[model samples]
Target: MNAHAATDTAASSTTALPLKEQLVLVTGGARGLGAAISAAFLDAGAKVVVNYRSSSQAAEELAAAFPGQALALQADVRDAAGLKDLAAAAAEHFGRPITTLVNNALVDFSFNADARSKADELSAEELTAQFAGSVLAPVAAIQAVLPSMRQAGFGRIVNIGTNLFQHPVVPYHDYTATKAALLSLTRTFADDLGPEGINVNMVSGGLLRTTDASAATPEEVFDLIASGTPLRRVTSPAELADAVLFFASPLSRGVTGQNLIVDGGLVKG
Candidate 1:
């Protein structure tokens, strides 16, 4: 969505606190799609805690821009202890439990054709690493935050997914498999947490342009994607941010355990 459209929505939602007093933790919030998501939450007046592994400078800069409203934290999702520490720090800083958790981290985004490996060629370590970031880490974060959310009786957990998992444009076997597993986790968590007033959902989108993650994508690949999509254009991180906000906001209170595809009709199934 364009800035003007987002501003309109924000204006409409201004009657409430605009997630201002709400504590939110967004993983991989240093750059790319994560950065856009963080910015969206910030614009909505949410108290954002941005988690990053190596992008410390970027994270700190983003947080500094928002002053007291943002906190840049360093935590590697692969490290369970580190994840717990970050979660604890976020809770401590907010002086209240986090009400929203956005699991937007990922590893092994390599799209090299020559690097493709089938099941037989894939190593156990590779599979484990992929799943650790895409699935296990999110699960751990959810576990860490569930008690607080349950106590407060309100929560929103959003898992970032990819449209490529459904379309298979490229054979990112390990990445696709792990993301598919995360989608399943989203539904399962939603079903398990619904009674507690917590909602779990997934947002899947096609190749998003202007993000660091998609910088490696060839121009021809994007051309092909735009031609194939009904919107005749690649999705943008800002556009996907709207879908994420919908899930986090009161607008989608009943939308749990669902995968909302924002690929501009690239994968209608």
Candidate 2:
């Protein structure tokens, strides 16, 4: 079949398997925002593969809550072989192909504006590391799951981005630049994969109220951000996770190659 025809085939095939039946693999799903995303998928009645590099205890604990519906696997997102193994193991355990992927893993980063490396002080190594985790990792993951998704003719790839791309309130130079690059990948991937019935999009969130990475943020900074937003409150991990669910869910079937900002109206895009 042609690319367009194949997409139609995949679209028609997906109607039989709703969100509740989807098999979702979330990278770095053992803690913080990753944990929330895993929980959101599980709560929606989808089988989740929680992939974590470390944080075994956290990953297992989160999976334990859902019993048979969730599984915790170990894999570094930057490793293509590991990601491929993770996909195979998840399918073997869940008895189905992975239908959705959430690229949420990020390198170790803190939200302390004061501690940020200034432009002149930043090193190429720092940018390279962020690129590995933020951009290359997602690329590896998408490659690992492409065969299954293409065969099934249905896939949802949601990349976790940052509001810093639009509003560079804090110069997290390395982190923000990599995320911007990921957004470019998001759009290009959407165009390339849409013909195969895969929807690639991005969810960019502001400084969350509390995540492991944001734990070091000053109280005043949080308040300052909240006061500047229309919601007058910081966004929660759960709230951001829900937006991911929307993309994974059938409700967003027609939407692709777009970036949805879920930061309490902080950065309107």
Candidate 3:
């Protein structure tokens, strides 16, 4: 969509759903960066549905603290059938269709530079499994929420990505390839759905300092990154969540199909 069209839509949607009343569904919202993003949205007055494959206790605690504003739902992103059930449950519990969707779930967090794997070494099954969590799941969630979003003439889709896809400092072949594919999907989806008044974008970050996903990274490696990074430090979940909020808010109505990197300027491109 052109800038003019997007601007018009944003102005019209200003009061459609107040920040606290909008229904937002965040995948992998039980912990880590996902949990941080959930908290940011709730703080902005959005009613959030935290989707967790596991980590039920963590999800419950978050929901309890954000009472009447957050709901915890369990569904594996890789399972299309399960995602359908998740959508139904979210709609029932929130009493409103989801207006915002965040795809933040990942399958595995392997960052071993010593491990060697080439295209030839990867099997068809391995490739499919990787894409199922990284690409297919987000696409499915977008499809599930499109009808309601289109009817309402407002939607925000934020897909979480990784910095490795951009810098390739670590040779996580399967992981990097799948995330790159997801970036492509994000752009194409934005082009296709922009006419329906939906904005789709991505937030890519480097090695986060204190998340379960980043526990595998050796301390020395993190220190090396901190030394070389322009910011001279690792990123935090809250910092990344702030970037996400900008995309989900009215401020980013004109932004879509772009990868906003929050890696402390580690990857300039």
Best by lDDT: 2
The top-ranked prediction according to TM-score is 2
RMSD of each: 6.9, 3.0, 3.4
Better of 1 and 3 by TM-score: 3
What would the per-residue lDDT of candidate 3 be over residues 1-269, giving only the tens digit for each residue?
Answer: 99999987676674244556578889999899999999999999898999998899999999998999999999888888787788778888877878889999887656556553665686777678788888898888888777767666688899999888869877677778889999999999999988777889999998888788777778999899999888899999999999998888877877889999998999988
Model 2 clash pairs are none
TM-score of candidate 1 on Cα atoms, chains taken together: 0.90
Worst 10 residues of 3 by lDDT: 12-21
Reference-based lDDT, each prediction: 0.85, 0.91, 0.85
Across 95-121, the per-residue lDDT of candidate 2 in tens digits comes to: 889999999998777888889899889
Q: RMSD (Cα, Å) of candidate 3?
A: 3.4
- Backbone clashes in each candidate structure, one number apiece? 2, 0, 2
Residue 104 in candidate 2, Cα distance off native in Å: 0.2
Model 1 gets an lDDT of 0.85
TM-score: model 2 vs. ground truth: 0.95
Q: Quote the lDDT for 174 in model 1.
A: 83
